[model samples]
Target chain A: MINKTVATLEESVAGIFDGATVMIGGFGTAGQPAELIDALIHQGARDLTIVNNNAGNGDIGLAALLKAGRVRKIICSFPRQSDSHVFDSLYRAGQIELELVPQGNLAVRIQAAGAGLGAIFTPTGFGTLLAEGKETRHIDGKDYVLEYPIKADFALIKAHKGDRWGNLTYRKAARNFGPIMAMAADCTIAQVNQIVSLGELDPESVVTPGIFVQRLVRIQHQPAASAA
Target chain B: MNKWNRDQIAQKVALDIPEGAYVNLGIGLPTRVANFLPPDREIILHSENGILGMGPAPLPADIDPDLINAGKEPVTLQPGGCYFHHGDSFAMMRGGHLDICVLGAFQVSRRGDLANWHTGAPDAIPAVGGAMDLAIGAKKVYVMMDFLTKTGDCKLVDTCEYPLTGIGCVDRLYTDLAIIDIHQGQLLVRELADGLTFDDLQRLTGVTLTYQPAH
Candidate 1:
């Protein structure tokens, strides 16, 4: 009776509106939910503000989404990479906006959103150019910069396994931002390799609890191109 | 002067790391340090993406798309390794849980300010991943880079002209020509490449240098 598994990828991404702030989990392509992103592309939500570690790699997934011209802004720590040509061009042509935060700040800010903290004082960017124009505080002899939480309307993540209850477990380094993003978003949509039966996943090992995830879709296979 | 090659510099950095040290190697040159780490030492490598106890690059047959380093390259997880989320991963760096972090830099001021993330070029797309956190968070920040730019300008400067990654965070600097330590705003020469004199090192560096070899 507590099923959250959706029938189709379209249904999983349904109800996402234009101008929504979306968090896509991944550090590069490791945990990127390519299938869910492809579905979102088809869903046709425009002017999205995306939050991720990198913009995209090569001409697929987040890059394909960016190439679709649906994103208006990207809030990420690093958007420039050797294969990030799509974001690079879009950024240079003044087609999209970028808010570059330090990697730790990005993670903690998202964590802060989920944890419901008003603001945090982190020493990661203290006294650096990134700290310029931001609030600063001296705490116990060390300078700290004030950063706010980054809450998203939706979070699209990939996991190794999940149940109908939406409890999830991630594999290896692919777990990157999935767990925290699931908590920081209003609606967390997850794509998993398999949907195990109830109580199949060990309660102790469940990374993202059912309380955080809203929808789950089992991706039977990864697209060959995206897998590489 | 018999300048040390990149691998030698990396090997030197590896030699400095003690056993049981937890180290994070930045992408590119810093990653080379891993190859030269003493076989006897049990050094745990941390990747900012969400892996601890990271191993070297995997063989082509062992490549797993899901398991990659911060550079997005396929890597192996060492025994006793663990996977974590970005929140916990960054927390490890920002919480000073890391013993050492070696990073690549564009410029490092004599005061130990780091400038590697951005060149301040208006046209350049600035992407600063975990550089700032590693710069400020690690107990010892070791920078590995070329002593001079390709065009013959010193990278070690009196003051960083580009956008800073972190201020006064670097402890030791390992360059091709010499190894220097930043202590209380003094650039103390630790070791120089064979046949490289103190004056020769000073002539190449933009900042003043003091000869104080490590014991």
Candidate 2:
């Protein structure tokens, strides 16, 4: 059923409980919900475990959440070459937990959760230090390694265009984790630049259908300097 | 010794590839090496989208609409190639199963530090992708990059200018001018790509390149 579109970011992101397992879309700040993130920060939601492809850059994207000391743990596939001062500080202080997976594994793990798969095996980190301590299983006389699934309580995404009913369209690399995270999250919220009526979006262009999305908020752009 | 250009450097690197190895060719210039792998070699090409035994870029008429690489470029699979679930393909990557991962580098430090993720911009996307995983995960990490960025700053440095994808993960640095290896905390100048001298390499590199042909 098409639901009421909320008026403001805070209202849309309200009830985003503390310690929510939030799966944020975007590969390195692309296609991230800037408005929802700001709302989450302003709301002071703490102890979040964000499953993101990339944790934004500097103070611009999800990295801001880390900088704000809002997140509790991070489960991800990509670890930045450039270390965030906030992340390093948090890590050194043991204030937060970090689990790093391979990029490919990151994508597959979330998909596995959405598909209800418990685990799968591959040859990724076989002989290296990565294989140490992990259960190594053999199938058909071949060495296969086991990797588990990752899921989340909320999925926050940025869409180039969306409908009040929650259908979404993402542009370019921005589409990276949004669709899959939408499927894996319990409550999916989309912060969009353009909100249109149903049937306005081309079926081919709709990456995440409305069925997966629960809330939609339209974001009005504010200049970078004025953004919190 | 010959004066090697980008193509020659690509061929030299391709020549070093052992038979039956599983290799991932990175984007841009490194992608060209797909043409140089010996056809008779029993190699398996792995693509991130879950294809194995990939042949090379396909002919226009032979293009299968369904076939492509991770970069979204059209490609061809070998005669016996198979396509599996994309999840399965990544399992091969993160599981540390690949023989080699050929990648492009923005910067490589002298101590074999790899920084190929993002330039330092506040809003710039932070972090490296599968590149980091492949860097540490692959048995061998081969970095393919020009010796110098457009600003004439050498990409290989004492400390990386960009973000680091992996700590001490790079094994070999293949360039248009020379090939370098990291050993005992020193940048060992292995072999010049061809016609390029140690001094020429030093002139281009910001970091010191130690030459010990006898050692």
DockQ for each candidate? Answer: 0.89, 0.15
Residue B86 alpha-carbon offset, candidate 2, angstroms: 9.8
As for model 2, its CA RMSD to the true structure in angstroms is: 10.1
**Lowest lDDT 10-residue stretch of candidate 2 chain A:** A122-131
Q: Give stretches of model 1 more than 4 Å off.
A: none
TM-score of chain A of 2: 0.89
lDDT of 1: 0.94
Pairs of residues at least 3 apart in sequence or in different chains that clash in candidate 1: none
Residue-level lDDT tens digits of model 1 in A20-118: 999999988989999999999999999999999999999999999999999999999999999999999999899999999999999999999999999
Q: Please provide, for model 2 over A14-85, each residue's C-alpha lDDT reduced to its tens digit, 9 standing for 90 to 100.
A: 888888899887554445676688788888889999887555456656777888888988886554425356
Give the Å error, residue B3, model 1.
Answer: 0.8
Off by over 4 Å in 2: A140-142, A222-228, B1-101, B104-128, B132-215
lDDT of 2 by residue, B65-156 (tens): 34666554667777888755435566676667889888888888887778776676654424345665576667788998877777888888
